[model samples]
Target: MAVSLGFASGAIVQEFYVDDDVDRSIRDSVEAETGQALVDVDYGDVVDGAIVWWRAEDAEEEDLADVLVDAMSNLDDGGLIWVLIPKAGRPNSVRVGDVEEAAGIAGLHATTSTALGQNWAGVRLTARPRSRR
Candidate 1:
């Protein structure tokens, strides 16, 4: 079964730093199920109204946190950030605790996590509500 990230049709989604295997699977599933194309973008792309598919294990935790913060500028209000990481016990898998800490630093919270495929896990996140000034 294809996993749902709560995306709607025509929603703009970006794939950032995911490996070839994971990226291909996500692209196929998103296109087939949601009709939303996952745009491949680098760190400097100006993005908005897009679900960001980030591969957390590609970088160190501290670097990933910084990248998340930077990605915030490109995200639209209510946009989802799906962080893809190597499955537990895999060589390059990121620790769950690191993911949580990075989310906190980036002002987002993880809503759910599920297996993306045989080699990857996906963590769905959303921006935290800002306090009224």
Candidate 2:
């Protein structure tokens, strides 16, 4: 799990809105593998990496876009941002297309995606480079 999530020793990672089960699994995996604890933070807190777990049906598309914008605001340069959603065909699962569209609206691109676990899948994103004046 840590390897897939790209968690590293001493890397600052934060989680937002992830379920307890998933969060515990990730935290324990990271600690066990890297011997480091992730720095968990709420929305609006800046950090080097972040994980956002949300059920697509829970919020409107616009709301999800806002959440992504806020999450991006808190990410550092060259940082990783992970968006985890319920797998397709699962109850209340979010569509991959919706997630990708929201990411584009937030000025990000989906670099990779993988199955997170039995119940969820993850999409990896990185901030778009800023345009110079």
Residue-level lDDT of model 1, residues 26-111, one tens digit each, is 66777766675667666355444334344444564447667677667677677778777778887677766777778888888888
User: On residues 95-120, what C-alpha lDDT tens digit does candidate 2 reach at each position?
Assistant: 87787888898888888988876778
Alpha-carbon local distance difference test for all models: 0.67, 0.73
- lDDT at position 18, candidate 1: 52
Against the true structure, candidate 1 has what lDDT? 0.67
Lowest summed lDDT window (length 10), candidate 1: 47-56
Q: Could you tell me every candidate's TM-score relative to the true structure?
A: 0.79, 0.80
> Where does model 1 exceed 4 Å of error?
42-57, 60-62, 129-133
TM-score of 1: 0.79
